[model samples]
Structures are given as C-alpha cells and as structure tokens.
Target: MMLRTIKRLSSRPVHILGLSTYNYSHNSTLSYRKLTTSASSQTIKREEQAETATVKKEEPDEEKPKLSTMLNLDRAQMEKDRLARLKRKKSDDSHVPQAKHIKTLATQTLTFKKEESVDPLPEPSTSRRGPFMTLRDLQERVASYVPRHTQYLDGVVKKTYVEGRERTPNDIKLEEVFQKDTLQTAVLSAYVWEFLWVLQKLNVGECDLVLVLHAKEDEMVHHYRRNLCNIPRTRLCFPNMSGNVNCMHSKLQLLFHLTYLRVVVPTANMTPYDWGEALGTGRSEGVMENSVFIIDFPELPKTSATPDSNPSHTHFSRQLLHFCKAKGLPADIIEKLDKVYDFSRSKPLGFVYSIGGSHHGTEALKNGVCGLATAVRDLGLKTKKPMEVDYVTSSIGSLNKEFLLRMFRALHGDDGKISVQGIPKKYSSRQLAEPAAAADESTESESEEEDQSDNKLWQDIRSSVRVYFPSRRTVAASKGGIQNGGTICFQRKWFNSSTFPQSLLHDCQSVRRGMLMHNKALLT
Candidate 1:
C-alpha cells in the first residue's frame, strides 16, 4: 500500500505543475491586452486634444481682425458725436443779444440846427423869357468879369485882342488893363455883395467856407470876398503856397451854385496836362478856365459849452488881438471898424483863405482835417448840445473820398445818416459785389466739370458689374440655410432675382461714382 501511494503522489505533482503553468499563461495574455488597449485610448485622446488646441488658436486670428474693425467703428462714432456737440454749442451762442447796439448806432440820422436870422434882401422875380445859358455864355461871363491880372503869374496880365485889331497906323492897346486897387475895389463892392447874397439865400447859419486860391486871376474874386465880407481867417494854411484859403461860409448855394466859378486851385506848379492825368483820363473834357470852391458847413453842436457869466469878452478880444498880431496888422484897424451886427452871441460869421496852401503830405492833410474838426467842435460847443458836422472837402476831384470819409467820422461822433449808416451801406455794397461776381464765374466752371466727370465714371463702373438670374434649386437651398454654396449662387438666388431696369442701374452707378469721387476729394 506504501509503494502504490508514492506512485500516485508523483503523478498528482505533475498534474498540479501543469495547472499552475496554464493559469500563469491566461493571466499574462489578459494583462498584455489591457496594456495595449489603454495605450491606444491614450494616443487617441492626445490627438483629439491637439486638434482642439489648433482650432482655438486659428479662431483668435480670425476674430482679431474683426475686433480691430469694431474698435475703429466705435472711435469714428465717438468723434462724430464730439463734432456734433461743438456745432450745437456754436449755433446756440450766435443767437445771444450782443450785436444789437452796433446795429442801432449804425442806423441813426444826423441832426442839424434851425436858422434864426433873415436878411432884408429883395427877392428876384422868376422870368421864363430867356433860354438856358450855354457853356459859351458861361465862358463869356467869366471872361468879361474876371481881371486878366493874376496873383499866380505875379501880377502879370495876359490878353487876347479882338479880331482885326492886330496892326494899325497908331498901334492902340487892344486889351484893357485895370489897376489892381481899382479891380480889388470893384470886386469887393459888386462881386462880393452878389456872392454874399447867394450865400445868404441858402440860409446856412454861421458856417465856415474854404477858399482855394492859386495866384491865378480867378483868385481875385476870393480875395475880394475875404476883404469885403469881413470874414476872419483861420491861422492854418495849406503846405503848398497854392493860392487857396478856407473861408467860413454858411450856405451851399453861395459856394456851389456858380457855373462860371473855378472852385479848386492847385498850387503845386502843375500844368493843365499834369492836372488832367492826376485827376483821371477823360476828366479834362469840357473843363473851362474856372476857379474851384468848397462850401464847408460848420458842424452842429454835439454837446453845449458852458457859457461864461461875463461872456469872456476879454478872451474874445484877446483872440482877435492875437490874430491881428500874427497877421502883422494894426489892432486899431479892428477898433476903428464898427460892430455892424451880431448874429449869435459872441459868435461871428468869419471866412478863411489859404493862399498857395498845399495839403499834400500825411501830416499836412491830417492837420487840415484836425483844423476843420476843431472849428466844427468850437461851433458845437457854443450851442451847448450835440450836433452833426458835414465835411465837403472840395467840389473838385482833387480830394480823396476815403480820406474825406475818415475825416468826417473823426470829427463827428460816427452817429448820423451820412456817418455810420449811409456811408457804410455804400461801401459794403461795393465790397460784397466784387467777391460775389467773381465766385459766380468760378462756380459755374467747377459745377460743369464735376457733372461731366461723374457721368463718365458712372458709365465705366456700370460696365464692370455682372448680374444673372438664379435657378429654383439654388433658391430652395438658400432658404434651407445650407452653407455649401458659391457667392454667385447666393447672389443669383436672392439679389439677381429682381430685374433692375437700365435706368435704375445707370442711376445707381452714377450715384456711387459721384459719392466715391466726392469722398476721395474731401479726404485729399
């Protein structure tokens, strides 16, 4: 029984070893399969993660450009809003009441005083039997009355004899020569009185007259008026020794109404040719040998002067005395004269004559203007109220219009129809008309060029665009939101479905081209 048990135990050992080996092989196969499966799953997961990371990186690149575009649009919108606000503020400020005072002052009229005195002169009866006087008649009247002797020629007499009196058995003096003293007396007695009558008829009250004299024979008339009319001479004289004086005259008719008078005199040694050129071409036509005159009316009072209790007769006498001393005249002459008549209290009607006065330079002209202004001011002060001063520099064209206007405003308070309102309107109209006329010419040219260019550009752009109709399938696909389609398919299905007329296409192209060109021009 021992031998048989040993044999069975050895066989059982062999069986147990075989079973252990089989179990080990099964466990090894299961572990190898699990390792391979796990490695494959990990590799798949890594590939998927890398693909997702790549997609995310590419998405930001596309979104970055879109973000930049959005930012630019926001900035443009903000700038537009800022400009709009500024425009609104400017518009609001313009409506405020600040320019109204200037407007009111610019439209005020000038004020003048009423005349108080009248001379007991006989009025002339109107006669309609005579024809109107011609230029020849005026020439004849001037030649017959004015003396041949002139101060300008230093007392030289120029004569023209009548026809057929050149040679004779006994040569007779054809031209008549009168003594200076006799001529002066005659002018003072007859011509001056007539001139004064003309002045008195105008009713200009207590104004100064400017008499321009050039040692010409015509100046004798002015001298006679000055000596006989008893007008006082102002201390101021023109720089050029032109025979001219500014006499105080009260009325316009007295100074400007004479058709035969030579009102303006040039003392600057200018010939007729030179004078013609200086004045302007074509101005010398029909100019006769006549004298020039300016009737400068005194300024009305802006504010009244305080009258002295004693009327300061001493000051008045002293001023007269000084004037006499300066002119080297005897003060007793004034004393011997009778006080003919006093119009306004302490204010005498006077005249000034400038013999060879030349207001050429800036300083001389300024002084002339200032002297006139002061004279007007003194008259205004006498009245004790605000007044207007009218400045008529010369009836002749020798005076500068701009300079005269400036002088007028400087003397007056720039408050009158002639000063602030009337003059500015005339000047502004001239200033505005020039630019407006020029702009009209340029605008017409530019508008025509722009229209032609726009038409050409529109024709070119219209030729480049292509359009077509879409199929039913493409339309159905687009309606289903299908993404797989060409741009042509989408455009044909939606945009080209509607037939655009030739007129409409042309208009759209034209508008687009015009808008593009306009924007480009503005940017440039």
Candidate 2:
C-alpha cells in the first residue's frame, strides 16, 4: 500500500506541481496586467500635466496682444479728451475780451450818432447889407479929415530975405557962406524933383504926411524944401533933429496936434528912441492923438565899412535897449519883439526899405529892418496899440489908389501868381497892362540875384570892420580868437552898389565903427 501510495503521490505531486505552476503563471499574468495598467495611468497623468503647463504659457501671449490693443484705444481717447479741453479753454478766453471791446466800440459809435442827429442849425438874417465891410469904410468913419494938399518950402529959408529983416554984420558974406549951400540946395532940389516925379507916376495923394526922422541936417533941410514944400508943403513934418531922442518926441507931439496920418522915414542912426519919441507921446490925458503909420527904410553898411568901425552911428539897433531902459519897457515886450522881427519874417519889408533908403550892404539892410521891426512890435505890444506898417519902395512914385490896389494884390496873391506866366489876359495887352509889373519883375529878379551876391557881403563887412577897428580885439580875445589870423579884411569886388543901391557909410569912421561894435556886442 505504501509503495502504491508513493507512486501515486509522486504522480499526484507532479500534477499538483503542474497545477501550482499554472496558477503561478496566471497570477504573474494578472500582476503584469495590473502593472501595465498602473504604468499607463501614470503616463496619462504626466501628459495631462504637460498639456496644462503649455496652455498656461500660451495664455499670457494671447492676453498680451489683447491688452496692448485696449491700452492703445484708452490712450487715444485720453489724448482726444485733453485736446478738447484745451480748445474749449482757448475759445472761452478769446471770446471774453473781444466781446467786451466790441460792446464798448458800439456804445461810442451810438453816442456820436445820436449827438449828430440832435444838433441844431441857426437861421440866416434878412439884412441887405453884407456882414463884412471893407477896412477902408471903417477907417473913413473913425479917421479925422484933413486937407489933401499942403505947401512946403523948396530950400533952406534964409533969414536974410525974411519979411522985414535987414542985412546985418553977423551974417557971413553971401559968396563965401552960400556957395556950397547953394549947390547942395540945387542938388537936393533935383533929388526931390525926381522923388516927386516918381511919386506922381505912382499916383500918391496929398493927404499923406511925409515924416522925416533921424535925417542928416543937410538931407533934412534939402528934402524939406524939394519934396515937402514944393509939391505939398502942408503935408510935411520935420522932426527938426537927426537924433532919435528928438525925432520920437517930435512924432508924438505932431500926432496930437495935427490929427493927421503920418508915415515914418526910417534912416540910418534912427533907433527905437526915435520911434518911441514919435509914437509914445500921444493921448496921455484926454487928448486926441494923431494916426501915424510907419514906413521902414532899412540901410545897409557901406562896402568900405567894418564891424569894428562902430555900427551904432549907422544902425538904430544900439538905441533900442537904451530906449527901453529909459522907458521902463517890460521883458516880455522885448522877447516878443525879438521873435517877430526875425530876418525871415522881415525880409520882404526889409527889401523894400533897403532899396528905398539906398542901402548898399545887404546884411546891414537886413539886420536894420529886422531890428526895427522887432522894436516896433515890442513897443506896440507894450503900449497896447496896433500901428499900421507899410513897406514903401523908392521905386513907387506915390501912394495912390492904383498903387494901393497893386500892393494889396501883391501881398495877397497866390504863390507864383505874380510871375510872368501868371499875367492875366487883360494885363497881357500893353494898354491895360500894369505898368509896374515889368519893373517889379525885373526888380524882384535882380533882388534875388543880389541876395546870392550879398550873402557874403556881411561876412566881409564884419571881417573888414574887425581889422580896421583893432579896439575890438579885446572882445574877440576872450572868445578864443578872430578868424583868418586876426587880419580881418574885405574885398571891394564883393560889393555891388547898383543892384543894392544903398550907402554903407554916411558918416565918419569913428561913428561908423562905434555903431558897428556896439551892435555886434549887443547882438552877440
């Protein structure tokens, strides 16, 4: 039983072993399957984690583009808003001030418009007479009437032939005493006749009184006989002396007595003293003063004359301040006179007087007229009186209606109206033409040419005067020195007496030099 059992056991054992092996194989297979499943599950988990990481990295890039676009839009919107605000601010600021200015302008315009709309107009008068009358009418109503013509003596009235006078031992011999006197009388008479002839041509009337102021003794006596006594003796008044002090006094006294209008004959050595003497003595106390006018005759220095020789003897300017001081004239009067009597203002009048007075030196004539005008203006202002001033030319024969008409036209005519091209049709014909026009044109042209020539005459005169009168060296020494090495000299070639037609030296050198120096110092 044992043996059999052993054998069966062995076989059974083999079978059991085989079954165990099979079971082992099955277990291995199952284990392998589980491991494979576990491995696959791990791999799937790793894949899922990698995919998640990649998706996270990719998500930032995608979001970055979207954010950049949104940011750009936001920035554009912000810039637009800022621009809009600035534009609104600028518009507000510009509108505010402009609106205010426009409103103010509109208000001003409206005010002016209303003012113009409400203004009133006056009614015209029905009177037949015109509002403005001529100056002549007023003069006639106010002026005193006097005889048109008066007789005057022809020559010096000698005491020998007086009504009842007999020849006396005191009278000098006729031949010895009267030889020069007679010749002078004759020459003066001729001059007077020529002057009267010229006056007749000018158509002067007899009502006008001829005043001789500051004339030389000989000239005064001569003119008195020839012109004053011969044509209209009653219409003449002699101041009796050549000095300014006497002349002024005579003028004033005559004005009060005759009640006649007189014209002044300004000559060399006539000063403000003469003017004041003649004009200042009128109507002080309940007295009817005469109407007097001034006819300025300015004389220039002689060609041979010098500033150092003394202009006081020949020029009335030196007496101006002295007269003012004596008369106690105000400073304002002096200042006004200086300004109004400037050369530029007095040139036209000065030219007339210079030519009439036969003044040769252009500068002297200009200076004299300027000084006289200044003195007259000052005197008038101080006295509160307006004196009529007329420029009388030696060429003008007389003071007539036609002469006055011509003068008025000449003074008031437009610029260039008196020229040759401006002659009127009526005046173009010889019969109806103004006789004086041609002469006046010639004279004017000559005067213009003379001005150019005479411009240096005064400078030459001053130089000559300085050289001739060395006494003025001290005056010049203080002001550095004289020009041209202290040798002041003038040439005769520069002098033109025909065109100028005036005497520069009427008296001695001492008088002339003193007068010139006095005037120079004062002017300087």
Candidate 3:
C-alpha cells in the first residue's frame, strides 16, 4: 500500500509536493513519514489502553462480601433451626417426667419446681494461716481484757482479739449477754449494709439499741426496707457528709448493762469488708487494721473497784464518758450509763482527741507542732524521767516534719522531725528537764499516780521522737505480717513483749514470709 501511495505521489509536481510535504526529499518521504506517524499513533494507543486496564484492576468499583461464599449457607441455617427446635422440645419435656408411666400422667397437672438457692459472694479473708507472729499477733497478745474481776470478763480475755484471728459476725459474745439481759443497751457506728448485717447477726431484737449509722439514701437503701425501716433506732452520722464533714467519724461500739460496761474501738467498719469479707484490689490486696477493746466491769452487785483502786479504768471511763456526752447520746442511755459509770469517779488520763469543727482541727494542728510542755504534764511523763515520744503509725501522711517535731516537743519537751522519706534526719530527745507547766495542780496530780501502776513492771518509755512508716517494699509485697495499728503497736509491742519483745518482731521470717506490710504501718 505504501508503494502504491508513493507511485501516486511521484506523478505530482515536485514544487507542489515540496510545498505540501514542507522539506520532504521525495513524495515517498511524505509516504514514509505518514507510515511512521500511523505506526507511532498505534503504539501510543496500545500503551494508553494497558495503563487504563491496570488502574481499573487496582481500584474496585464495588465491595466484596465478608462471609465466605464457599460456605454452606443452607446447611448452617438448617442446623440453627434444629438447635432451636431441640431447645423448645427440652423445655416442653421438662414438665414431663423421664419415666414413660409418669410422662403419660403429665397431661393431668404438674406442680412448679422450686429452684435451689444460690450462695452469695465469698467474703475476703482477714487472717491467713501463718507459722509465726506478725505485729498483729503481738498486738493481740498485749491487749488486756476488759470488765476485769468479773466471770464473763475473765473468760473473755482468752476469747478477745488476742488470738490474731479475723473477726466474725458471731465472734462477739456480747450478743448473747445482751440477749440474756434484755435491759442491756448497745450502741454502734456503722454503714447501712454493715448495720443491717450486724443487727441480723447479733439478734438484738428491740432490747435497747442506739446506732450511729452512715450511708446515703439511694435506691438500694429504699429497696432494702426490711432493714432501713428500723432507722429510728440509729442516730444517722456520715463522714464527708454534705450537711456535716466531721459528722461523728468515731467508730465506737459501747455495750452498757447495770452490771458492767463494754467499749470497743475498731478500725474496721461493720461491713463484711471491714471484717475481712471483701477482698481488696491493687495495693490493698491484703488488708490490716488496728482496734482497741475496753470492758469496764463495773464494781456493781457489790462495790470492789474504787477511784484509786482502778485508776486506768477510771481514766478510760472518763474519756469515754466525755466522748458520749459530747456526741449527744440519748437522755435515757446517758441516764443508764450514769447509774453505772460516774464521770466524777473516773480518773483523768491525758489524751486530747480530734473532734468536729474548725476549732478542733486547728487545735489538733496547734497541738501537732507546739504545746510540748503542757502535753508532757498532761501525759504524766515525769519531766525528770528519761521519756521520749515515739510515733508508730500506719499512714505516714498523717504526720509531717513541722507537725511531728511539735508533737515530740509537747510530749518529750523537745523539737525535731526525722528524715525517712522527705522528713529530716533529726529526732527530739526527752532529757531530764524542769517541771512541765500545767493548768492546775489538781490536773497534774490526777494524771500522775495512775500510769505508775502499769509502769511498775518496767522503766518509763525512753524511745526518742521517731516516726515509723511502711516501706515501699512492704506496700508492693502481698505479705500482711506488719501491724496496721498506728502508734498503738509500739505500746502493745513493748508492753506485751517486755519479756521477749524481739521474738515477735523476728517471727515474721518464719511466718508471713518476712516483714511486708500495708495500711502504711511501719512495723513487723
């Protein structure tokens, strides 16, 4: 075809062809250029078609199905229907007896079957078996029984918190005593859940009941009316409460009868969690707490104890009486308490508690870092006696440098805070000093002679101003061999182990896996 086109162009005029072909040497040159142009155009068209096909392949116009198309959809549907039908048949056959004879009688009538009761969640364990004594075991060992010189009180010494065992609902024997003497009165501070559970457990049916309760009036509280209906017996109290922040935060359990009076100060609440019913999480995987129990076996039935005979009891009675009176106890309960324990007869023990109101917090703060001379006299530590202030607590955050020094100065007549974490490395020492300045001679003399009785066995406390707190290792470990009792542990540790105190402290190596702790307590 090219040759035919060249022949036809050859017959044309050279100048005419030259003008048409521009600068072509021959008409065949024009034919060859056309041929090359046509070939190049065809090649470009083929490349463009290839590029368009690749783009279309890379980008899908529509989405694909998620489930496998190869699956047997019909078979799966049939299987599901068959399972549903079998479930329905099972439900229908449930009423019919398995025996053929009994199945025939199913058309007559069948009684509804009752379901078995499901058990509630298990409670957390407060105490696990240990081969040796933790500070807790030592604390229990040192705590003395209350209502001494009485049949019940003496037997109670062994049954008290001395065993280092977890507290149980039935562990409290006061329940039986209260039930027996229907005239006995009992007062407790608790959360609603705890109160209800305790009330149910104690079996204290309307015999005198005074409760200091804490809990919000939520939907659950309304639903649990069987217990909430008895709200009349409780004097409502809450902490961080909207109406009142410091509204009766004290956890006191007082049982009063004409014959005797029992006092229990527990760090734990009435809830199962407090009594090791709820397992802890995170840092509190293992929990520990401190508690104090005082049984004032009144010198009733016949007068045995007197103002001087049992000064410790008298002092405790006075403090407790003051607390109750200030708490605005019921007139009847107050009257009953007065008949047994007379505050006038109580011996004075120097202990200033932190109470409600800004004034109290301020006073606590002021007392924290200052007023050493007065506290020394108040605590009845002979200014001349080598006495030092030792602070052993579960929560270290409760004390700081400025505050600790002030407390030590007040108790030991010196000043300083030590360096444990951010604390300084200086401790206050209580050297022989001049007489402590006190409010009155009567107050000084009153606090003086009583502590002597207990001190008869040992010398005065000479431990310096030292703050003990849980270490980082203790918090991380799951071991609960350390005492949660704040400063109380020091007294218990020393008092009980005066004979072999180190034995208890060292026992952790054999038992609790070593001195690991929580609750921030800095003890064995």
Most lDDT-accurate candidate: 3
State model 3's lDDT.
Answer: 0.35
Using alpha carbons, what is the TM-score of model 1? Answer: 0.19
Comparison by lDDT, 1 against 2, better one: 2
Q: Per-candidate TM vs. native?
A: 0.19, 0.16, 0.43
Sort order, TM-score high to low: 3, 1, 2
Better of 1 and 3 by lDDT: 3
Q: Which candidate is the best by TM-score?
A: 3
* Tens digit per residue, CA lDDT, model 3, 433-506: 22334323433443364234324312232233344444444544524433432322234343343353221121
Name the runs in model 1 displaced over 4 angstroms. 1-332, 335-344, 348-367, 380-394, 413-524
Model 3, position 76, has a per-residue lDDT of 39
lDDT tens digits by residue: candidate 1, 1-524: 00001011111211100111112222322111111222343453343244322323211221222222212223234334434543543354443221232223223311100111111122211221122334564454445443322211111212211122232221111111111111110111011122322222221211223322222244654554444343322111111222464432211111122221111121111122111111222132211111122212221132422322222232223333333333332333333211211112334322222222443322221233433333344445323223333211112122222443434333442222222122333343232343656545644664475345544534432443222222334323332122211221223232333332222121111111111000000000
**Root-mean-square deviation per candidate:** 50.3, 51.3, 30.8
Candidate 1 displacement at residue 450 in angstroms: 47
lDDT of each: 0.25, 0.26, 0.35
Per-residue lDDT value at 453 in model 3:
32
